[model samples]
Target: MLLHILARGRIARSPEGELLDRYLKRVTWAVKHTELPDRGGNIPPLPAQARTVLLDERGKQFSSEEFAAMLGRWRDDGVREARFVIGAADGHGDVARGEADVLIAFGAMTWPHLMARAMLAEQLWRATAILSGHPYHRAG
Candidate 1:
């Protein structure tokens, strides 16, 4: 399955962007990153088997192992793209949240969008590594 991150805000040539690139490069699965302006950019078309996951403050928090399992399940079920949406500073609207297949949260604390992007990228790498029997993720 393709792991796609469709996020709001330009990451630019910043540390977060570098971190995102480094982790994403280590991921064995197909990965794509799409950045939109803080507002007004249309989300791209999704595949028929696409699964949308929105990152929100009220979203469910999953352990690294569990997150990997979720991706594994989607891959096994023939999902073509697992699209993770990270909204603007104001966060996602009700419409987006309602339409998402899953709403995920890193924690209760709010993070800058750029930092969140980097964190999400690292988590994606960890999840894929866990799925591929890699020792990078040492789960407790």
Candidate 2:
């Protein structure tokens, strides 16, 4: 399945962007990153058979293993694309949240949007690694 990250705001050239890129590079699965303006901008059309995941403060927090299992199931079920969306500072609207297949959170604490992007990248890498039985993720 394709892992697509649709995040708001320009990441630009920064340490966070570099970190995000580094993790994404390690992911064996297909990956795509799209950036939207902090305010208004056109979001790319969702591909057919795509599942949308919205990152929200009130969302459920899943363990790395659980996340991997979910992704594996989606892939096995022939999901073409899994789009993870990171909204702007004000966060996502009710309509967007309602339309999402799932709403996930890093934790209760608030994270900077850039750092969240990097963290999400790392988690994606970790999830794929865990699914592939990679030694990179050692769970107790």
In model 1, residue pairs whose N, Cα or C atoms come closer than 3 Å (at least 3 residues apart or on different chains), thus clashing, are: none
Weakest 10 consecutive residues of candidate 2 by summed lDDT: 41-50
**lDDT tens digits, residue span 35-125, model 1:** 9989898899888998999999999999999899999999999999999999988999999899999999999999988998899999999
Worst 10 residues of 1 by lDDT: 131-140
- Provide the TM-score for each candidate, comma-separated: 0.98, 0.98
How many clashes in each structure? 0, 0
lDDT by residue for model 2 over 60-108, one digit each (tens)? 9999999999999999999999999999999999999999999999999
* Runs in model 1 lying further than 4 Å from the true structure: none
Measured on C-alpha atoms, candidate 1 has an lDDT of 0.93
Cα-lDDT of candidate 2: 0.96
